[model samples]
Target: MKNYPQAARILVAIDCIIFGFDGKEIKLLLIKRNFEPEKGKWSLMGGFVNEDEDLSDGAARILYNLTGLKNIYVEQLETFGKARRDPGERTVSVVFSALIKIDAHDSEAVRSHNASWIALDARPKLIFDHEEMVARAIEHLKYNAALHPIGFELLPERFTIPQLQKLYEAIYNIPIDRRNFSRKLLSTGLLIDTGDKNNNGATKKATLYKLDTEKYKANFHSFWNFMPDSMKE
Candidate 1:
């Protein structure tokens, strides 16, 4: 192999912006760094890309290590190559967007890593360019949620129509018409009536439904247009 002139060695890192939605609100998974230039401060879960591992595999490993969960929805959002982004070193980070069922993660693993689920509006000031990454993730989420059924990643296997509506409302931060929303959702044929009701409610219980896995998987890429014209932007 012919040797070329010396090239600058820079680090490549992976940062994940994990979003979770409960029946009420959307949340973010953040870690309080225990060691480094920004110790004891909140930041996105991340690590350096190992020399021997593929980028996607490295991201999955890091995510599993932090959340103790697998098979979660993950997508490569964008790459941040700003030279001065990381104060500890010259690093280019590939930011990833992830969504997981909030109640499914192992609490012990999250505690071990000093990570917590923070409300989107109440999140602490993050270190480095993490804030920018999160903003972009939210923008991407709103854009995608309007067109695809990606919001299902944050819900449980069985949920009520109201619960599903709440999740979408949380994502777009807007109110939805119950009659129209329910009618539109049922028209998709992607929901299966589970023959169960949410008995936990004090008032009248709402019927429960589950995703028709075959249909959801088959039509995931199709445009949903679930939101109104005013909210589509």
Candidate 2:
């Protein structure tokens, strides 16, 4: 090992992109910045990493501190290390993307940060590189939704077929043919009708369904098609 001069100190931070789905749209959780260099602007939940903490731990801690949510489905995204990324310090940031049910977490701490869920299509301008971070997170979500069953994370335990279709439509940002969509999803045999109906003032009650986890696990290989030529590599 070689010794160098004392001018090489670097700082590390963790930023979390928390994505939520209402029945209609994909939304992002944003906090109003309270510090200088972007004060009063919208930003992702983030903080400096403590000396003894792992990057994942730091990301989780920051999210919990801001939103009081723990054990969410978070995955490590790319690290951003552009030299001028932060004007206040030589900082490198490890970003994480999380998918969570919109109403599953504590809301008090989030309110303290002036946090709000904004629809992805109508998000406010964010501070720092947070906009880039969100773009990457959306890309990751789109890819993962095509290949895995992770889209269920954005929904409640039990949902109707229409609800499931709406979730996929929100992720894809396009209209899906109701007939084809219903045919494909029903043919999968991964959904079980619960013998119940969602009777929330609709003219006709729609049947509720839940995932057959065992079957989903067994047939996952044939359930998803991520290699479609239309998907960008």
Candidate 3:
């Protein structure tokens, strides 16, 4: 009657689909393969689960190791267990997606493993079931965008209203009504106008706004028209 007799065998792995928005296009962080099975190809940052670590901890460790990013907003995505998913071994990958501000981390380390931020619209062929993982991650992002306030995580601290609108449009892949979008966003009172205008390449200067972090974090669950009729459950 030993506890070891009741132990279960489970294979777990962490795959990170890091999403970044660079003002115009939505991009995904991909790392080129350095080992066999798919050497010299693009893939998501991932690693095997450790013996004494939780799934999230393993994911954070993998991300930290690859890009020196920490405390990012990581969420569990899906579990891929197709028999032929891995050619080297029979394993289950627990995928995680994170939204990181492009300017938050050092870019040099990220570029070391041939890492590059490829625009989602122009992504190359990916290895294993990673393409599927990225698709699911985008869907999750869309769904979450309609409900949660996670979109701000992908933007810089100080951003223009147009930039914010562009981020939303990029995530949804649909053009939002400019006037209505701006009105609704301003009505939320989550943004603090810095009273500063950006003079970078525009005839008319745009006012810069930053997320009132304390206010946002405190009242993130406030009522809003986030979810559409389809997502209502």
Please report the candidate that would top TM-score against the real structure.
1
Worst 10 residues of 3 by lDDT: 224-233
* Per-candidate local distance difference test: 0.89, 0.82, 0.84
Question: Where does model 2 exceed 4 Å of error?
Answer: 1-7, 201-204, 213-223, 226-233
TM-scores across all candidates? 0.95, 0.87, 0.90
Predicted structure 1, TM vs. truth: 0.95
CA lDDT of 31 in candidate 1?
96
Please write out the lDDT profile of model 1 over residues 39-77, one tens digit for every residue. 999999999999899989988998899888887899999
lDDT of 3 at 191: 90
Residue-wise C-alpha lDDT for candidate 2, range 172-227, written one tens digit per residue: 87766667767867776788989998886331388888889898668654647522
* lDDT tens digits by residue: candidate 3, 18-111: 9999888899989889998899989998889988999999999888876688998888988999977988777799999988888887688787
Candidate with top lDDT is 1
